[model samples]
Target: MFPITADWMSFVIVALATLFLIGELLVSTKGIFSILGLGFITIYFASFLDPGMFFVMIIIYFFGLILMIIDGKILNDGTLAVIGLVCMFVSVGFTAPNMVAGLYAVIGVFIGGISSFAFLKVFKKRQMWTKITLFDQLTEEAGYSSINQSYKELVGKRGITTTDMRPIGTVMIGDEEYSAITQGKWVAKDTEVEVMDVDGTKILVKDSEKLQKKSAD
Candidate 1:
């Protein structure tokens, strides 16, 4: 099993190495997965390359792993993650002695990457990923309600526009200022307007004078 030589063995070795390596990042395994991954990858590369070449390939593989971590923790985007997979595949492929073995190794990297997610279900996930990706629903019990909830209470309140309302401007209601929109009508600054409705955070308003004239009709 050490220093795998058969074409099919390339697939098995590469897959196991990738699975354990990525699993190490997804959940806490106390370094067992890391040791296993390093052992298998070292064996696969040592099987066909000189010592110098082996070191170069190993460095390339780990560089790919670093890119994946940076993408997840900082970018919160998948771009670097995809590039990392390509890097791992290339390292394994280039180390293989033949085209068939290279092809097998590349496929193994893809399969192992997808299977690593299974660790998330079986073990407690690493806490580092939670800060950027997971979020709790905001509720009153959490010491606060959603921001939109407070905006809902402002409906029917009268205020004066602090800026010209070319359908969108700022208004002062009592002592507080709010961004508001009119019904596609332009109103000069200092004109009185009433909050006609509130949809989520959006405040819809109409000129108070126009509203009273319509009520009189």
Candidate 2:
């Protein structure tokens, strides 16, 4: 009865940790929840058992941590699921041979560390693949009137063109992008253009003249 109770508690601890770790992944609140979850599982495992059982629990805890980090950082969802199943098999299978306990623990930690490193490298590469843009002097209002606020009123307002325009294009103001006709015609690519008139999304501006004025002011 006592052994069964302990087992149940251990299971609960592990289950809660796993769920919390999963939550950390979905909700991107940084790794706070995940670290908490790991702590819970570690305490539960380490506190409730005898030396032998404690050692085993430690192995399982570290194994689970590695699995989670790999899941989050390296493997896609499907692949992580598969790895989870495999880890379960390993944890369960190692129970029979007490002599090889240390080996199992070492192996689990090694797999986890390697997978985590790989995940970090992949994440860095992904960041490199993305492009970031900045726009200044935007308005929170809507429609042509809002456009006017950003352009005519915001004589020194700066904005980014969302779409390409032969001479006319779209510029962002606050949270809204306005249609702006260029001040001196053709505005190419992501060239920083200024707001001249607020017709609507229709904004009129030369290349960065208004931005310059805003900076001077």
Candidate 3:
């Protein structure tokens, strides 16, 4: 069923491989999945390589994992993540028992990434990505509150741009400051604007003077 011609055994092997390896990233299995992942990956490599090369390939695979952690935690850019994937694919392809196993391993990694999404719902993610992902919505202390029905009241109100709205900026509506955006228009600071829409906390606005001029003409 894999891209390459994988036998029934290859299916079982890749499933366990991805399960433990990718599963570890998804939830905090507390070293359990790590141990299982290492064991399965070792078995997959041992089927084809000598003791010397087997250890080398294992190191490369873990190195790829380290890069992924760096990408997720430190850099937050995707550069390390891509490099890490290439490293892992190379390790698997080079050490697999046959062409079929190599393809299966690569496919397994992809499925594992997709499957990781499921963990976010059921499990508490303690990973670094959690810190950067929608933290404002997670807590009110960080200055993020759910958009209440009252926000609709200001939809037609006029305001002044507190900052340059290069599409997204802040505007002051009456005495309250709100984060708002323009309709793909560049608005300068201190310029007058009118709220056009409020979808939850997303406030969309347009230049009030431009609207007035258009209405007058």
Candidate 4:
């Protein structure tokens, strides 16, 4: 058995290790929390444990962390994360020197997991966090963008009138020509105009001078 002065020493080590490990997983700390947590966890594993079983338990524990990362970051489904948490708690708990120590370890894990939530406000997010939340932002991308998305893209676009107009005329936007009209202002053929509005099939044009002055204001 590894040397330990008191039962509380295991609790402290487990708690600290669990805290830092969970913190590292939850947010980006540039690996500082991971290093510190790993150190404490390694120390805890080495103390009061059989050498032969040490590597095995550690593997089980780390495997749990990997599953969590996969679930939280990759899958975004809770299935693997739940299993991972169970694996981690069980591994740490079962490895303790006694039932009391085991209970402390499990409590430490819970406390660590709960407390790690606070880090969200202070730290930059892991890429996986995006998967877990605000998934509805994609609703804008799926079909809401619309075929007339180009209509909005046309806003402020520059075009030239193809034919003379008292007000209504054909305008060239890029290589493709579009039917357009000015705001009740007469314009001549080949004059440059900016898209003022597009409503279904109707396109409105503005003179460059008017558009420039309006934009400046």
Candidate 5:
């Protein structure tokens, strides 16, 4: 015969909630367990009747939230485990008519508050997470090869500007139009200008003397 006040059901719920929290942490599947854990705790808390018990539950919930922010993974898991143990002990050890209800209420509060906070933190942080890419490493290697190549060899190199660069524009050097800084002052249209210097990707050039003299007028 189960005590009218204390039942195995409370212990079972707490145990299950703890497991859910653990699962959520281990799997890193967002805040699924966090939500469920809080829901279980809320239900348990509601079943109990003491004003003082609710207050205690609120305190526990607040503590868990604080721990969650600073401690994150460790606190999230630890709080659930501790609360689960407490709930199990209270449910099984005491048969007072109001004991189970009070304990359940506390458990609910602990789970709801802690889990909600944990879930929100995880959700917010997830957005900023970035995956490591092989291209990042390759960029350095590629840049080295690109830098070592001769720009002077491109003196006569020709390319179209991808963007209008006022007096300067992109000139297709081989497959890439480098940042062509024109020396001609103003080389409108796709007028041809020889590569004067290929200091890095900046291609410096001037309009042919004929064009320059005509523009000077």
Candidate 6:
């Protein structure tokens, strides 16, 4: 024990640890926040529990934190996050010296986790979280966007079906081939087709012969 007489100190220590740890994972803090968080958590656990229990509790807490990070960065769902928070709560609450300290520690975990978001406003976020959360969007200005400008230019142009469009197949437009759909029509291979629309990467085409026949009718 670290000779801490105050029960509220548990809350303070745990809260600061969680805040910094979560902030470090969510944003780019250059490891400063991680160090501070680890330091506080170590002190908090060491001050109340035996050496063996201390290590166990620390492992549980970190396991929970890892789960939350994984959920936020990859799953983008609350299921794993909820389980992770529960694990953290168990570790801190079980290691406290008394019921009051346990409750305080639990509340601290929740508050600290929630407060970690404040750091996002103060620092540049990690690229992984930003992408998963859609905080950043891919656009033409990004220099390597997936948006293909060539497909957009193909609208209203004439082409020939290189493969049978059992509504979907390839079309040859001026020696360049593109994947195209025939608006639910089954046009045969080698049929003349005209580019009707372009939605993102999807190219919609219609049979040029049918279009001419309809026009003549």
Best by TM-score: 1
The list of candidate 1 runs beyond 4 A from truth reads 135-146, 215-217
- lDDT string, candidate 6, 76-183, tens digits: 788999999999999999988899999999999999999999987889978866556765458777665564688888989999888999989999999899999977
User: Each model's TM-score, in the order given?
Assistant: 0.87, 0.31, 0.56, 0.57, 0.31, 0.83
Model 5 gets an lDDT of 0.52
In model 5, state the lDDT of residue 162: 54
Task: Give per-residue lDDT, candidate 6, residue 51.
Answer: 91
| Candidate 3 residue-wise lDDT, 1-217, digit = tens | 1232344354456556656676677677687877877777777777767899988988888788789767866787999999987887788777666777677777766665566667667776666556655444544576555665578789899999999999999999999999998889999999999999998879999999999999999
For residues 135-212, write the lDDT of model 2, one tens digit per residue. Answer: 133446422244444346755577677777677677775677767676557776666776555565455667785457
Error of 6 at 188 (Å): 1.4
Ranked by lDDT, the better of candidates 1 and 4 is: 1
Q: Order of candidates by TM-score, top first?
A: 1, 6, 4, 3, 2, 5
lDDT of 6 at 119: 88
The TM-score obtained by model 5 is 0.31
Question: Model 4, residue 145: what's the lDDT?
Answer: 40
lDDT of 5 by residue, 53-154 (tens): 755653454354444433444344566656544543443233223665446534643553345445444443332222311224435555654443666577
List ranges where model 2 is wrong by over 4 Å: 1-6, 48-80, 88-217
| Superposed model 3: Cα runs more than 4 Å off | 1-8, 127-134, 138-142, 145-217
Q: Is candidate 1 or candidate 4 better by TM-score?
A: 1
- Model 1 lDDT, residue 69, Cα: 78
Per-candidate Cα lDDT values, in order, are 0.89, 0.53, 0.77, 0.79, 0.52, 0.90
Native-vs-model 4 lDDT? 0.79
Cα lDDT for residue 21, model 5?
54
Candidate 1 lDDT by residue in tens digits, 68-145: 878977886899998887888899999999999999999988888779889989988877777776556667788765
